[model samples]
Target chain A: MQLTSPDFPRNAAHALHDAALQRALGNLKAGFPGKRAAAVARLPEFEALRDLGRDLKNHIIEHLDYYLEQFEASVQRQGGQVHWARDAEEARAIILGICQRAGAKTVTKGKSMVSEEIGLNEHLAAHGIEPIETDLGEYIIQLRGEHPSHIIAPAIHVNLDQVSDAFHQHHQQYGKHERQTEPRALMNEAREILRDKFLRADVGITGANFCIAETGQTVIVTNEGNGDLTQLLPRVHIAITSIEKVVPTLEDAATFIRLLARSATGQEISVYTTFSAGGRRAEDLDGPEEFHVVLLDNGRSQMVGGEQQDMLRCIRCSACMNHCPVYGAIGGHAYGWVYPGPMGSVLTPQLVGIEHAAHLPNASTFCGRCESVCPVRIPLPRLLRNWRAREFERHLTPQGYRFGLRAWAWLTRRPALYCGLTRLGARLLRWLGGRSRRIRSLPLAGGWSAWRDMPAPQGRTFQALWAERQRAAGMEGKR
Target chain B: MTESTKRAPAAGRRVALLATCLVDLFRPTVAFAAVKLLEDAGCHVEVPVQTCCGQPAFNSGDRADARALAEQLIAAFEGCDYVVGPSGSCIGMLRHYPELFEAGSAWQVRAAALADKSYELLAFLVDVCGVEQVDAHYAGCVTYHDSCSGLRELGVKAQPRKLLASVSGLQLKEMEEAEICCGFGGTFCIKYPEISNRMVSDKCASIVASGADTLLAGDLGCLLNIAGKLKREGSTIRVRHVAEVLAGVADEPAIGDGE
Candidate 1:
């Protein structure tokens, strides 16, 4: 929630050196992409489905206000309420008011990135209301007193041993004393602890994967059924989501559901795809007594008509980060914000000011893998380049980098002069390289030579060699 | 006959070699090999007087400089039938030049014309020239590193491997994650050296795990970065440009290796 993006370089360096984090990241690289490729291979219309998903999101976002109003009316018609929040503060206040009105001592929660963005837990705690994370991954991170390093898998950066330790330390008071080593055992332990909280919580909160305008339904796709239980068992249920989560119809929501699980975890479908519409009906056997939807604008309205509009189509699949080399290396904590990876690089600048999160965009190699694999086909590299252009325009880029780029550009515009200077520099480098033909270190280029040798030039420029060859051919022809 | 008249034209193809700044300065053999490959494919090869492709500036968000360099490149190879380069990244930059100009402007038209005709070397060879297999040989187990631009932007993955299949005694051993970037993203390696170092280190480990004696890649930037890391780790695996290997001019010392 706080901006540590200014210290991204240091954060990334720290993550790189963290052996535990590196071990966690290794599993991420090994697990996600291969499964996604296999899942994609199984579906013949996967790419076509992606196109439909993109178009559907685009259509909805273009008429975001209409869709939002439609969704609100549908909720009201279903005996539910829609609350609008202009920003995070407003959203936090609305949720706190709801909790106070319900006389809630403890509120159970499903995994919600929006809540993290709004600092909801801290706000709730400050107001003397306890918020408990119900998702297994979110609960692990909550126990460790840490933020989610991943979008879908919050505790993905925490290895099994760490989770085992956290549960051991925290679950002692819950009458569970044995340390669990296996994943199944750990899950059962978390399930037992969370099941009690689920029954006792007065109000339950969950983040919606999509809010269907056709039926006023909030859809959440989770591997664990905690979201279902969290919203179902409580006296009151609140679905908190951003405005862009609205779709024109249930069919549009279905199209996105097909892609979300496949892109996020490489599943054809998540185990639990829960759709909750309104309060308990007269015919209903069991459900929440009251239902509410909190729509948080939080700087998204401005992004709708800008260069970053395409980002609103993101399904929070984590596919971009899954395939991102930088994110794979440094993990998400280094991003220093709620969202991380390629999507975060472009979106963070808009959500936080570019001045604060400038490094996020510049930290990429522009590898284009993220764009190639994104289900919505967001041109991530192009957007990053746009951010760089903005950063340059605002004079936010370092002065030394700006000067160096300017000098290089000036030299490149003049061919003969550039060639001559390069020739001399190549010769000098060759001489410095001597027999090894590589520079172990160089002035001002220590960043390159710090970890790897700088390959020296081959002593002669191509133009000079070509000219000599042409001269020799001319002489032979004259003879 | 005058010198110009003495030179025989090859089917009037008039191909111009935009030996990217990297090839021109760091490894001219790649350009030489590119010329040979083009000439062998029955196209007249010309070395146009060119500087950088302005990718450094273009990627850094300096459009004015990038456009100036693009204009210079367009002027240099205006009459050429086709423009080819040994590096996929540079040729990709050429293809992207048209986007830098305002639409419908004269310069925009010229940039589009240049972009339309530009091609990376191997793509031009197999795709345009219709060459089935190159008449070259290298006896070794070598893994090919697909540079990001050539592989992603130009669909260069199969082209090089297709060409390499014909080389006598050259067994192609596929490395794990061969398509992953070697972290030589022009300025990216310098800006984020620590992260870049980690990436290249991973790449080197993969290359070693593949048990290949040599490594080849289309772009010299990635080759140099990978070679530098290999050398730092005292790796015995040699690195060279794919163009050099395919042209049979790979007898020269490997990249980052002493003469």
Candidate 2:
């Protein structure tokens, strides 16, 4: 997908006015955040579990090479093949090679963020193989010829009407005539239509929530059960994920899974927590004939031991974005990448270069909400600040902002100049306020004054008045 | 700050008031109100020479300037027993000062010392100074907006409400999503005003829905943003710093009251 991250401000401005997207975003207020809060309240040991998860992920990352080799060997022992891709280019090529070897005409996929990160669907389609998304949200967005706006809920940005419209426009070839607007009706339609593709597809690609090293198993947590169908029904099963997802054992994976459901959708356990040990055994009645695991490093290898290594602990639960006010305001599409919100802000810069995605980090208010609710307790605000520091050091910050910060810093360090400027600034602002005591427009701060009236300074700095009070009362003399 | 206002409680412990650049320039009355509250709680308060906590530079990734400012603040208030400020944001910045210096260095030790002594006005009043209620009176019902830094960073949520509960003739109505950010994130408001506007607009809607005639908060940045948007939307909600109400100096005028 083409990246619009450089135009974040433009995308955000346009998103704010888009009535449909706003209405869809409004539902987020009533959903995940409240449920997650309730779920966390129900489990008293949830915080302790989070700490364990963090430590486990840290240990796994520190020994990533050892565990990955162990995992590959285990997968081979279990009659499954594992492929490592250093980056997106190699990852896509490896997946395409698997499909071509299987002579796949059609491939069905469950929701996978790594797939989106690698731009897999478009690549596969361009190579003359049809890729079908079985997840209902994915299918709606797919029908609209759009990428998933949100990670878990792919078509969350599209409302019921938009779904009906997309389905009405695209479902004509399926011999379905009526536009289904009811939630149940739309689900049934999507289910019926995707059922055919799931059965007919030669290869299935799904994302792994966890890849257990000891058991050589991959896990996918879902509510719709589409992942089970996508992997089981196809002749070839391919689980595509990033390298940081590997865990040392099933027990460690269990700990992460416990945190994931509660943080992601507030469920004790998702309706379907399916695990694949390997391809079907000789006597197995139903399972794929060939099983393959594609591990994509992308930028994760460099990130493993860096300052942003904390980000690798993310279980993709999206608790950060679910509770983020900034995400609540603009929705996911404005982030202008496959990932959006807090996790996206950090990961996007790592995957995509910081120059192209500079606005992502600068856009936050550093409110600390994302950090507070993050399941793995990634210090998102600090990471975002680190990016800002990186930007400033690299001369990537906007010239006006850099100069303003420099002037602010210089004046602040010198109390005398700072006080003088503040006193004069107070007087200027108060006079600008005139009798109303407010300025509707400011000289250079149009971003603030354009929409909100700046409350005028109360006239004269506090120190000046305090000095007068001190002299009159002989207060400092007594001190 | 130690000499004039009220009698000694902790044997007249010297507390330095940071005065935060915003409270100093935009709302000096908040500093005075803070002084009155501190003095009434049987403590001495000192207004030291200060400009800012370097939050703008720190948050904008200007670490060199941020560290310079932190070093200066540590030096300026070293003589005082405690450093208190009316802003959660500025005081919160001080709490993270140790991160600016090299680990285990002398400067880091001083930064940690400075941070340990720093407290937001409301938290210090209730938590440290043992202030239960105020002699202040305000007749109107008010809903408080929890500034994010104070709420999350310093745990200033219940202290303000607990104190506000005792004010004579005051009704503390709570707004839904009061803990959410009002979008006045220092430079964040200026850089992303439209998004900030949307956030503040939602905040205003919640404030309006609470049916309170007035709004109070600890930080001036949030107050200015909310008050600015409240006025632009033509709402009659009077806005004031929480310190003003607690000190009973609210009679001066609501923020932006003159014209």
TM-score to native of every candidate shown: 0.98, 0.98
Candidate 2, superposed: residue stretches over 4 Å from native = A475-479, B1-10
Residue pairs of candidate 2 with colliding backbone atoms: A436-B259, B1-B45
Indicate which candidate wins on lDDT: 1
Candidate 2 clash total? 2
The lDDT of each candidate is: 0.91, 0.91
Off by over 4 Å in 1: B1-7
TM-score (0 to 1) of chain B for each candidate? 0.96, 0.96
Model 2's interface RMSD: 1.4
Q: Across all candidates, what is each one's fraction of true contacts kept?
A: 0.73, 0.82
Clashes of each: 0, 2
Colliding residue pairs in candidate 1:
none
For model 1, state the Cα shift of residue A19 in Å. Answer: 0.8
User: What is candidate 1's lDDT per residue for A114-177, written digit by digit as tens?
Assistant: 9998999999999999999999999999999999999988888999999999999999999889
**lDDT (Cα, 0-100) at A47 in candidate 2:** 92
Residue A9 miss distance in model 2 (angstroms): 0.5
